[model samples]
Structure formats: structure tokens, C-alpha cells
Target: MPITTSSPPIRQPCPPGTCICNRDALLDNPAADPRILLLTQHEEKRLLARLENCASLDDLRKLQQRMEQQLGLRTEITPGHNEVRSMRGIRIVVHEQDGLCRKIRQSIPAAIRRGLERNPEVAYELLNEHDLLRGT
Candidate 1:
């Protein structure tokens, strides 16, 4: 004897105001923003430490790649052409569509200032090694 298959049941729409089917409509709206992830203090410290350890532009590039992979943050670094090799520009790209990029960008300077206050030696080392003191 051959096995037989039965047709699957059809989905029926919920009656008006009877179900929460309209919840999906909220997702369809264009104005809805993507969820943003705010970094904790510990995470920010870790990021700063990693940045402080960058000895060269190549190291910074590697750190940038690691940040993208680990934290979903896109970092762009522009090298300066001065007596000391320094970062001409540093910015976080909002390519992930998350709203955290702007906050992170705003907080970076303050974080760096705090870190420098805590340990000026490390900051000096970073400046001497990677020329990351001028524009950044």
C-alpha cells in the first residue's frame, strides 16, 4: 500500500479586535528605529585599554577590525602627516543603524580625558609609540 499525504490546514485571519495581529503592523512602519546597545563602564574601559595598547597604525587597524567583530562598532582612523605620526581623524561609523554610534563618538573624548588623568604615563606611551596624541 502507498502512503498518502494530507493537505495542511490554512491560516485564517483573526476577527476584528479579537487578536493582536495588528502588532505586526507596527513593525511595518518606516519611522521605527533600530535598537541601540549602550556600552557599560566596564566595556568602555576595556575599549580604552585596547586602544591604549595600540603601538602602531597597523595595530590600530587590527584593533578596529576587532572592535567591528566583537562590538559591532565601525571605527575609522585617519593618519596625520605631522612631525609626530598622529591620528588626524577618528570616528565611529553608524553603518549598523544603531543609535549608539553618536553617543560613543561623544563619549570618547571624555573617556580619553579620564583615562589620561588616571594614568598619564600610558597616554604618553601611546603618543610616543603611535603618534596618537595630536588630533585625537
Candidate 2:
């Protein structure tokens, strides 16, 4: 005997009134505005901590539910809002910006070297001195 496999059948998207397929339609629609994740700085930090500490798939799922609850609370607090909405896409913008900042910071050392080439003594003095008057 030989085992055989078959792919699932492709089905048409559900009609607008019949199911929640309208949301999918909205996503595909060009006129709909791009969605933004509404998490605050504190919320984003906590969510990152939760995600980092998630040990298993089940733990991750629970964290997801908590995030959903937070989103629901936000929605209740700020009804009739056009821009802010919730989705599973969070932490991405923060991470991207962090990476950009890191790159900028890394280039600063090279910039300091260039400044030193122009005037070595003043640049070295500035780099070496730190908070002498601050009692550190």
C-alpha cells in the first residue's frame, strides 16, 4: 500500500453580509487608510517584555490574549477613532527605529575621528573630559 496526499480545495471569499469577509475586502481596497498599531511607549515595552519572557507556544498565546484585552480597553476608551486600531503587528516599528538609531550611534565614532583629523587637541580634550563640574 502507498500513501497519497491531496491539497485542500480553493474556496471563494465569503459574501459581504454572509461572513466577516468584509474586513479582508477592506484590506485589499486601495481607498482604505493604512492601519497603525496604537500601543504607547509603556504598553510597547511591557508587550516586548512579555514576548521575550514567553517560554512556550501556550505562554505566547496567553500573552496574545492579554494584548487583545489591552486593545479592547483602548477601543472602549477611545471610540470613534479613525487612526488607532489593533492588530498582531507590534514591536516592528520600534525595532526598526532602534536599529536605525544604533547605526547612527555607530557612525558617531567615525565622525569624531574625522573631527580629530581636523583639530586633534580640542577633539581629544572634549572626548576625554566628562562632567568634571558635576561632582562625578
Candidate 3:
């Protein structure tokens, strides 16, 4: 069996004792206004953020929720939602950017180049500086 949907049946008193129009007849009339599909409130906010360039971390999280529904993997997680939100998504390589870690598994070559330009001797000492900075 297939389910059918139409205008919902509403009970209204017949004026002056005339019978009310039957529900089946009302269902035959077309709807005055058709429904338009809409993005969820959360999704709309996310797109605005990307356009407006002022989205907070929390706003991104809401957008992420929507993307996770459609695109997936907007941010990396430590395995669960924290008590707080943080900036995540689309990793960027800045002229000088490195994760703070106990040991430098990856080196900031760009930063090293800048340092080298400052002093050729310092460029030669880049690895040594990393070892020293990590206190290893």
C-alpha cells in the first residue's frame, strides 16, 4: 500500500446549517504557495562565514556539522568533541608555520630560509637550532 498526502483535514462548522465541504474535495484544489527547499540555519551561517571573513571558531563548528553531513571531514579531532571549539579545516602553509611539538619530526624549511637570509651562518645552523629549541 502507498501512502498519500494532501491538505490536512480541518473541521469547521457549516454556516447557517449548510454542510461543510468534504475533505476529499478540498484535497483536489492545488496549494496556493508551493514549499521551497531551504538550507538549515546552521548551513546558511557557515556559507556566510566563508564570504564575510569573520567567522568565529564556534561558527565553523556549526558549519562543520553540516559539511560532515554532506562533504565530510572538515576538521581533525583528538577523537571527541572538546568542552571547547578550535579552528580547524583546510590546512594552510604559511611562510612560517609549525606545530608545537616536543620533537621536530617536520621542520619549517620556509622559516629556515628566512633565517638563512638573515645570516648564512644561521642557515647552516638550522638543524642545530631545532634541536636546541626542542630542548632535545
The prediction achieving the highest TM-score against the true structure is 1
lDDT of 1 by residue, 71-131 (tens): 5566543323444322223222334343344445645544444544455554455555655
TM-score of each: 0.41, 0.26, 0.20
Task: Give me candidate 2's TM-score against the actual structure.
Answer: 0.26
Candidate 2: tens digits of C-alpha lDDT, residues 3-108: 9898433223344454432435444667653222234335445555555454443454465456446442111111112321222111122112111223322332
Candidates 2 and 3 compared by lDDT, better number: 2
Query: What is candidate 1's CA lDDT for residue 109?
Result: 49
lDDT for each residue of candidate 3 in 85-124, tens digit (9 for 90 to 100): 2122112121211111111112222222333344443322
Candidates' lDDT values, in order? 0.48, 0.35, 0.31
Best by lDDT: 1
Query: Could you give the C-alpha RMSD of every candidate to the true structure, in order shown?
Result: 13.0, 20.6, 23.3
lDDT of 1: 0.48
Per-residue error (Å), model 1, residue 65: 0.3
* lDDT (Cα, 0-100) at 45 in candidate 1: 64
Can you tell me which runs of candidate 1 are displaced by over 4 Å?
1-38, 80-96, 109-136
